[model samples]
Target chain A: MNIDLFFIPLQIQDELSLQNKTVIVVDVLRASTTIATALKNGARAIIPVASIENAVKYASTLEPGSFLLCGERGGKIIDGFDLGNSPFEYTEEKVMGKTLIYASTNGSVAITKTKYAKHSLVAGFINISEVVKFVSENSDDILILCSGKLNRFCIEDTVCGGMIAFLLTKGKSRKRLNLSDSTVSAIKLYKFYSKNLLKMLRESEHGRFLIELGFEEDLKVASSIDSIPILPIFSDGVIKALK
Target chain B: MNIDLFFIPLQIQDELSLQNKTVIVVDVLRASTTIATALKNGARAIIPVASIENAVKYASTLEPGSFLLCGERGGKIIDGFDLGNSPFEYTEEKVMGKTLIYASTNGSVAITKTKYAKHSLVAGFINISEVVKFVSENSDDILILCSGKLNRFCIEDTVCGGMIAFLLTKGKSRKRLNLSDSTVSAIKLYKFYSKNLLKMLRESEHGRFLIELGFEEDLKVASSIDSIPILPIFSDGVIKALK
Candidate 1:
C-alpha cells in the first residue's frame, strides 16, 4: 500500500490528483470531531462550504428549519449562524434530522477540496478507529490530508494525521508499505505525543488560541479517542455517516 | 526570541513578510551543502536563480570567463553547466574567485524568494554550527525555511531545520522562546534523527534517488557536521560567505 501524508492541504496543488485515491481529511482541533458528532447525533448530511458567504447562500436554498447554517471563523461562531465549530454544540437535540451547511476556517475548505477523491472520510481522534476500519478494508492508495490552520502547519492536525498513518501501517511489513517523508514524520510525532494527547493539544498554538477564547472544554472533547465512533464520508457535496 | 520554521518555502505567502526577519534556508540533501562548500573553497559569490532560464539569462549579463553556469535538473548536472550539485565538484581549482549562477531544483528557488529578508543564510549539516552562530548572535525573529523537494515535505531539510531550531533553543527557558508548531515539530524530528543523519539520508526518498544516480558521496559530504564551516548569506540577489 502507498501512503502519502501532506502536513497541509496546500501541498495538494491539483485537486484532480486526488482522483482514485482514498483521502482522509483531518482537522483534529475541531472540524473532524464536530462533523462526526453532528452525523452521530443524526444530522441528515453536511454541506461543507469554503466560505461563510457560500454557507449562507446554500442555507437559503434549503427549506427553512430543514437545514442549519453552521460554522466558525477565528474559533468563534460566524455572525448570525446557527452553531459554532465546537462538537459540544452539535447535540442530538439541536442537529437531529437537519442538514448542516458548514463553513470553517480550515477544515471545511479542506474537505471541499477533496471532492474528487474516491473515498473522502473526515477523521479526528474521536472517530479514528471507524475511519481506519473503513479505509483499511477498502483502500490501496491513501492520502492523509491535514487541514492545517490557514494552510500553515498545525501540530494537532499533523499529529492526528500521524496517528491515522501509524494505525494504518501498524503490523504491516515496512517494505510493503510505501510511506512518504511526511507520513514518517507524522508517525514519529504521533508516537511522541500519543501518551498524552490532551496535553499536546493544550500546548499547541491553535489550542492556546482556543483556550484564550474560552474553548478549553472543546479540547477535552476533541482529545477523547473513539468517543464518537463514526465515519463521516464527504461525497457529492454532502457528508453523511456511513451505514 | 520567536522561532518559526516552515517545512517548505511555499508556506511563506508574501516575500515582504520576510522583511526584517532572519531567514535560514535549508536544503540538506545538496543545495545548502553545495553552496556552503563553494563559499568555503573560495568561490567569489553565488547568484541563486529560480529556473534554468533565469540562470542562463543572468549568465549573459556577466563577463564570460568570470562566472560559471551551474545547477541540476533531476539530480544530474544540467546540460552544459559548469558543475553538478555535488560538494566534490566545487574544488578550489574549479570555482576559485569565480561567481556561480546556481539554479537547482529546490534550494535556489527558496533562496531567491527570501530577497526581502534581513539576513538570509543557506544551511546544511555541513555548516550548521557556523550558520547557528551567525543567527544566534545577530537575530531575534528567526524563520528557518526548508527548501523541500518541489514544495513537498522532505525529511532531510526538515531534520536539518529541526536541528537548527533545537540548537537555538537548547538551554533557553521554554517560556522565553516563542516556538511555532512547525518549529516544535522540527525540533522533535531532529532529536529522533540526530544520532544517525547518514542512515536517515540513505533511507530518505530523495537520498535513494541520488544513490541510484551515483551521487551517494554527496550525501556523505552533506551529512558531515561543520565540515564546510562557513556561513553563506544571501543579499541583493547574491550569496556570499559572511566575512
Candidate 2:
C-alpha cells in the first residue's frame, strides 16, 4: 500500500496529523526520543502543550504536586522551566510518577498538533524498533511526519523518518509500497546513512547548533537507536503510553 | 563560518532568499537541471515565471513564434502549455532560439523568490558540480535552498542540499566548517546515499510523481551529476549565468 510521508517543520506539520491517517510524528533531537526514554525510565506520562502559556495553564488544572513543567527554546531550558529539552535531563528522579507539562521549540508543539489524529505516536531513534513494529502490525496508510525545527526541514528528523521507511520497505516490493518522491529519497538516505548514524548526528545542522548551546552531550543519546523501548501515543490532547 | 541553512517548502521558501549571501536554489527533479541543460544545449535564455499566467503574459510581449510556454503541475503539462516539464521534450530544435516561458510546480516559483538575493542560482544533480565550484570559488556562505513541492519538504531537495553541504565542508576542519545539525546530517546522508543517485532518484517522492506522469526519463536527466556545466543565476527576477 502507498504511504504518505510529510517531513514538515514542527510549526506546520503538527497541524497536519489531524487529517485522519496513522501519523508517526518524529522529533529525533530529543523530544520524541526524550519522551520515549522518559517513559522507559519510569516517568508516569507526558503532556505536550503548544506553548509555555499553555503549559502554565494546564499545570494549574493538574494537581500542583502531580505535574512538572518542562520545555526549552533556542535549545536551552526556558528560564524558569522545570526541565530543558534533553533526553539526559529527564532522569528517573525528576520525571518519575509525574506528568511532564512539556513545551519545546519544535517537538512538543508538533506532538500536540497531532492530538486530533486517529492514531498518533511520538517516534525517535530511541524507540524506532517499537514504533515500526506497531505500525507494521496496524497496517494503515501511514504518515511519517517529521517535526522539523520550527516549521523548517531539519535533517535529524528526516533521517529518522527515512530510517523508519527503510525498516518498513525491507523485503517488500517497490510497487507494494506507494510512496512520494521525497519518501523514497528519505528511505534511500536512511539506508545510505545507517552505517554511520553517530557521525551523521554529530555533523548535522541541529547537532552543531546544540553543541554551540552547550548541549553537545545530547547528540550521543539521540543517536542511540532502539535503546529505549516505549510507545508514546497521543490521544485526548495528551501523550501517554502503555508499558 | 556559521551558515544558516533553511529547508523550507517551495510555497514559502520562494519568498525567503539570501539578500547578503549567495543563494543556490535547487529543484533537482527537473527545473534547475532542465534550465542548466537547456542553456548548455544552446537554448537562447530560458525565462522562468512563477505562474502560467505570467508565462503567457511574458510570451505576449515577445514574438509568439519565437517563444514556447512550458511547465507542469502535479507532474503533467498544464493545459495549453506548449511543452511539459520533461527534459527530453526540451530538445535543441524545440527550444533553440525560443525563449521558454517556463513555470513549474515548485522550481520556477523558488527562482522568482530569489529576486532579492545577492546571488541566486538554480541547481540540480545535472549541474551540481558546476554550481558547487561556482559557490566555492565565490566563497560566500551559501543558502542551498531546495524548491520543495508546494511548501513541503521534499526528500530529493534535501539530499541535493546535503550534497552541496558535503562538498563544501569536505577536507575541512569540523570547527572551520561550522554546521547546523541539519547541515551535518545532510552531508552524512549524501555520503551514505551518493552511491546511487539514479536509484535514489527512481524512488523519491518527486521522482515517482514524475514517473507516474510519464516523465521517468526526466529523473535520469536530473540525476546526472555535472552533466550540464552551466550556472543559471537569478538576478532581478531573471535567470542568467555567473558562468
Per lDDT, the best of the predicted structures is 1
| Candidate 2 chain A, poorest ten consecutive residues by summed lDDT | A9-18
- Per-candidate TM vs. native? 0.99, 0.83
Q: Could you list the iRMS of every candidate? A: 0.7, 4.0
B64 Cα displacement, candidate 2 (Å)? 5.6
Model 1, residue A232: displacement in angstroms?
0.3
Please provide, for model 1 over B10-60, each residue's C-alpha lDDT reduced to its tens digit, 9 standing for 90 to 100: 898999998989999999989999999899889999999999999989998
- The 10-residue segment with the lowest total lDDT in model 2 chain B: B8-17
What's the DockQ for every one of the candidates?
A: 0.89, 0.40
Model 2 DockQ reads 0.40
In Å, residue A204's CA in model 1 sits off its true spot by 0.6
Model 1 interface RMSD over true interface Cα atoms: 0.7
Error of model 2, residue A50, in angstroms: 1.7
- Give the C-alpha miss distance for residue A70 in model 2, angstroms: 1.9
Candidate 2 per-residue C-alpha lDDT over B1-243 given as tens digits, one digit per residue, 9 for 90 to 100: 555455653324435436677877888887887788677766777778888888888888987588788898887889988888888888887887777788998888877777777788788888788877877877666677778777766667778888988887778787776666556556656776688988877866667777887878888888888888788877766666555
lDDT of each: 0.93, 0.78
Off by over 4 Å in 1: none
- Which digits, one per residue and each the tens of the lDDT, describe model 1 over residues A1-243? 999999888888999989999999999988998999999999999999999889878887889979899999999999999999999899999999999999999999999999999999999999999989998898559999999999889999999999999999899998899999899999999999999999999999999999999999999999999999998999999999999
